[model samples]
Target: MLSNILLITAVGLGSFRSVQSQSTPSICDNSTLLIDSRQVLTTAQECTAVAGDIVIQYASDYPATIEFPNLESIDGSFLSINFDEDIRVTRLSAPKLKSVTADVYISRWVNLTTINMPVLTTINRVRLNNLPSLTSANFLSTLESIENNYEVTNTSLKEITNDKLPFAVFVEIFDNKELEKFELKGLKNASYNVALRRNKPGVEVSLPALKEVFYFEFQRISSLEIPELERVIGHFVVNDSTVESLEAPKLQNVGLWYDPSISITNNRGLVIQNSGDSESLSFPVLEAVQLDLVIRNNSALRDISFPMLRRVTGNIGLEGTFESVRLPELDRVGGIFSLGNDEAGFNCGDLQAFKTNGTIRGEFSCPRYQELPTRSSSIGESEKEIKDWLNWASPSTGFESFRSMGAVAFAIGISTILLVL
Candidate 1:
């Protein structure tokens, strides 16, 4: 009887050991895990804690749903890439994921429609690219900071809400076709550059609270209005865009790097007027430009008025068909002053004074010579000669004189020569 009881006890102990051996294994056995398409994640215990990187490569045969409800932080990078032309992964949810110590890259997932990372707030860097079908990306609602760069390119991301990321070095958004508006209403500062280029037409960019930046480049945008931008430590360039109007009400200084600091060129539809309306382009508080201030090739531009512009440390080049050019408050220029196209004529006395006082560094051009004394004439005599010349060169017949002045300016390298009438 004792032998039979011992045998039964041993058998029961063996059964319990067998059950323990068949139970679910811990998924965190290794530091790194590479989940391929052939594997299946059936339970949450499959990924409890990853000490190292977690790379997920999607294939067509993989499960459509991927969720890690218990994952709170990744000690290493989190990378997801789908090479298959027909991606089967539709949803990825990591509800409790809060931080990633390294970079997070999600690229080439053509068919991925949704991504949910509700509590993710911090990461080292982020790159979201080449996801065409991804129209909505609200996964970064709580993202407050990034250590390095933040780049979003070639995606369908439309808008970014007011998220103040003060730790980022640079933010670049380009080649997004369907993006219509971008609101950085909460961003008050950045450490480096902010470049927005090649987006859809008529896109409105509002940076209401941006106070300073190292560099600011806005290319191929429709309209740019930065009401609170005060200073740029580097260059400020707006080129090849369809922006009809531009206003930076509080911009006080530009070109901390030096020459070619402020360039507004090739915007065919840009206009400058002083009508006290929103459509008119003006920089009321612009105090100085450290380098070149170029305004060229804007065909629709009619008038230019810089009321409070005080100084330019570099050259100033203006080449366009403008009806009127007014710089009533311009006090000094450190470099050359060159203007082409004889549409608006200027008084030679003003040009001579600016040149004589060492305010203009290089060649100055005056396309239309309105009135001037002869080589052997005095100042009083020149005044009478100018009046008589004005009678002949009336507004109706000014076109011929403009043509003549252009030819003469081209020949002599000076737009107008103070020749006797």
Candidate 2:
């Protein structure tokens, strides 16, 4: 009995000492914990899990390196932002962090250099913006799944290639001046837009497994490869880009959404091809474009050919300097079919049959087939030209037909000499 009491007393004393060591308040024990100074950060070093948000921002004299060695999870968001531009932290590391239930938004940190979240795997959303000094982030390589969206802008990272991520609702990766290559090898579809704009000039993009998207827009890109893309529901725009050859070998239907011109609605019209700088633009097996097929301003393409295209429900506008156009199987166009070129020998005689045969349901105008203007003069210019040409013409029977009333008219008389015999 004596030995049992002594052992119990020793165990109780050890537990009491352990509780006394943690005298400071836990940062995770509240709904929101703000870490503004080194002392505040030190007080949270013992916490293993944060039930609420962890906001770290608006501090100038921060430690050189901030780390959470024991933090495992955060039910809320992880935000680090400052409007006054005073955050001077160099590295933000959570080596053991694996999940964040909410977004991980880190923005406007002018002096941050590295984001060393090595084992982070899942999150809701991530927006890393205006981190000019951030060179690399280890979490991007290990992330396999995400929820809402992923957006990154104004960073110095060179490449973002992920073969693990399969799907995302919205993605915007732009204004990263040093990004060189972006490849999403496993992404099968994007239910919404996947836009990459204003990135590096010569960035190479490869979405080999993408089959469909709502709207796919690429700008300032040099090389793009989408070998398996089949459908674009909204718009497929490649503007201000320098891609040499664009071959959508499997793309069949473009603008398969609700046609805006069908009803008196507020939706915008669908456009398939807006602008590109490709030398060869070919959609070999495409059969239909539900709405407008605006293939214009493709300056370097020598030909606009869709050999198997059958119908265009909306307008078809093709403006380029092409040597020839080959749309052999086109049967109908619901709206205007406007085709113009700057080539000398470009002809449109064969296309006139579509209009006469009623294959085109709306207005049609091809090269050399448009009707000339019947009334080609203004009223004022016509009167001036007519009066100048007919020098002997008298003014109209009006009082002030002439503009200058002070001028007088001169008459020449013909004299006849009579001889008396």
lDDT of 2 by residue, 1-421 (tens): 9999999999999989878656435668677778887788887766678888999856656677889888888888889886355655778899999999899999888788899988888998889999988888878767778887878899988987777777877778889989888888888788787889888887889989999877678887777788888777766667777887777877776655342223211111233233456777657667666445666667776666666676665556666665666666666565566767666656666555667676666677866323211221354543442233223221111011111222221110000111000
| Backbone clashes, candidate 1 | 1
- Candidate 2 residues lying further than 4 Å off, grouped into runs, are 1-25, 258-277, 368-421
Task: Write one digit per residue (lDDT tens) for candidate 1, span 1-421.
Answer: 9999999999999999887554433544446656665553553334545677777776556677677777888888878875576777766778888888887788888776667887788888888878776676665546777788777777776775545565467878788888887776666666687888787755677777788876677766677768888777655677766677677777777744222222322211112222122223567667666445666666666555555565664456665655555555455554456665556453344445556555554556664322211122355543543343323211110111123123322100001111111
Q: Which candidate is the best by lDDT?
A: 2
**TM-scores, each model vs. reference:** 0.71, 0.78
Error of 1 at 393 (Å): 38
Each prediction's total of clashing residue pairs, residues at least 3 apart in sequence or on different chains, is: 1, 0
